[model samples]
Target: MLSDLVDLVLPATCALCHRPGGALCAGCRADVTACLHPSPRPAVPSPPPPGMPSCWVTGEASGALRAVVTAYKDEDRRDLAPQLGRWLAPALRAAVGQDGSARRALHGRGLLVVPVPGSPRARRRRGDVPLLAVVSEAAGGLGGRAVVATVLASTRVTRDQSGLDARARAANLHGAMTVRERQERAVSGAVCVVVDDLVTTGATLAEAARALHAAGAAQVLGAAIGATRRRVLVPANSPGPAG
Candidate 1:
């Protein structure tokens, strides 16, 4: 078949390292998993504006994690979604306490994984939303029991969040997203996990959460492929980088 011929010729090179057999080579896959693992201090949720929901950061946002997330998100390298989702799965599993006996204790709880819908502009540029791909792959890895929902939509087009501080970002997205009337039933009574490709100022995720909550989602928790950590920059003449 033509598909088989293409596979034979290209051999599916790894997205991270270009290894000619797997989606991600073993070394790069290990690095991705290590970068996304839960940190000692779980990110706390920031209070968002009305109609917006709160979001928590699970892992520290260092240069390494940010680089991987940015590469996939901004550069349109969607082939990395599966590998990124694989890295994200373990931390998400841990956040919900899926190891050992806890897994059964949480079974059938009806957790819905809803990706934060991207703008039409972004989709047009990228050809697809990265979070959807990540969430879909993650759902498959989770064995298909948990529901992966895309019940929210962007009702208004908004400016890109790049170059905006937290406050500006929040303002830009205010009143920009909404849950469609038909999809309300899907979110109601479900513990919604809002997934995104990255969280910089947390504005987008917060808005997405708010939309879901307004639609009657029981509880909304935030998850992402990565987040931005506060970095202390050392000036050239600064003493010991300031305590």
Candidate 2:
């Protein structure tokens, strides 16, 4: 639909291999799949920032997966949204399913899948919040009452996180996010899964969790499509990097 229209305007090229055809060629898609964990697994950052929620990841954020994420967010590759959503679905399911409290909450209060808010500056530059569409798509595939909520808001501007170490990243994001006042009632006593595109230092997710907890959410779990390999322990059965 929209991807086809966009492709017609600006010929599709694989984000990783630069092959002309689609946002990602079949070969590159296979390589990206190889990066995925055999199953979703815990992704705890070393020296995890305070307020960090229990988190899970679908794949290691390196090579093909990382390139795809960068292109989707910064390089104007909106066509990759469906692929990103599919990749994130497993982690989202695992985050909610493995938590006893989350599973129980599903029957009564329902589930909230909240994407970490994008910066106003970034949104202006990109013309959209790419994570929102992907999060909605993933949550929709959960087959039950998973609701995508844009409840969190960026409270202040922060410096770029690229060069920052764990501590600096935590400091930069501390007090940077808050739940919207109008949405506080919905968040009260809700079980929320705060999701992100990637987990490096985990500062962003921690901040989002903190804000949700402050607003009275009963539980706040975390999920992401990928995580930096150094901070997360990959499973032994996972396949080696793709050729």
Candidate 3:
């Protein structure tokens, strides 16, 4: 198969250390950290610009999760996405369970998994949308009849969020997203789970939740492979300030 050929030519290796084996070597994979059982929280609500999709945040963000996500997104390491997704699968499933307990709850329900659309510039530079791939892979691991939909599009280009503080990152994304009208039907009345590689200040995910709700998604849940920790500041008069 073509996929086998591609794998043959470009063997899988640990994205962090280039150790040959699976997508990641056992040791290196172990090094990739995760935050287990993050408490679910509502996504920070933003004002709808008249007829926008509803959105909600669902997990606590942590520094270790953010680091792994950053390594995957900024480092052009697609191989790591699946591994990261696998690690986060349990948490994602739990979040879904919280919404309902019905059997086949997610089956044939027209669940649309819309990853936060990345900027064209970042996609071009990275060679692919890592978050989309990761979410798709995660869906596969879910081992159910849930369908994954990719219907949203980034209508405007924006600057990369890397290296920017949370405030700046949020400002950079305002009004930078809009769903394609033709693809709007894919999300209508469906349980739309907004996927992202990571969440920091949550501005990006918040905006994405808004766009999906505007598209008529029945319920919008924000899910990321990892959450980012906000930097803490220490006072100048602290007893033991670092040199």
Which candidate should be chosen as best, given TM-score against the real structure?
Answer: 2
Badly placed stretches (over 4 Å) of model 1 are 1-8, 11-34, 37-41, 45-59, 98-106, 126-128, 141-144, 231-243
TM-score (C-alpha) between model 2 and the true structure: 0.89
Local accuracy of candidate 1 as per-residue lDDT tens digits, 58-169? 4556655666676677766566777777656654554445233224323666667788877777677665354788787775655535677778778878887788777888
Q: Which one wins on lDDT?
A: 2
| Local distance difference test, each candidate | 0.65, 0.88, 0.61
Instruction: Give residue 134's lDDT in candidate 3 (0 to 100).
Output: 75
- Total backbone collisions, model 1: 1
> Candidate 1's error at 148, in angstroms?
0.4
Clash pairs detected, candidate 1: 53-210
Tell me the lDDT of candidate 3.
0.61
* Structural similarity to truth (TM-score) of each candidate: 0.74, 0.89, 0.72
What is the lDDT for 229 in model 1?
Answer: 63
Q: Which digits, one per residue and each the tens of the lDDT, describe model 2 over residues 1-243?
A: 776676678878898789797879999999899899999988888878888999999999998899999988887677798989999999998998899888876656688889998767667756435599889888887766788989998888899899999999999999999999999999999999999999998899999999999999989999999998765567778999992
- What's the true lDDT of residue 43 in model 1? 44
Ranking by TM-score: 2, 1, 3
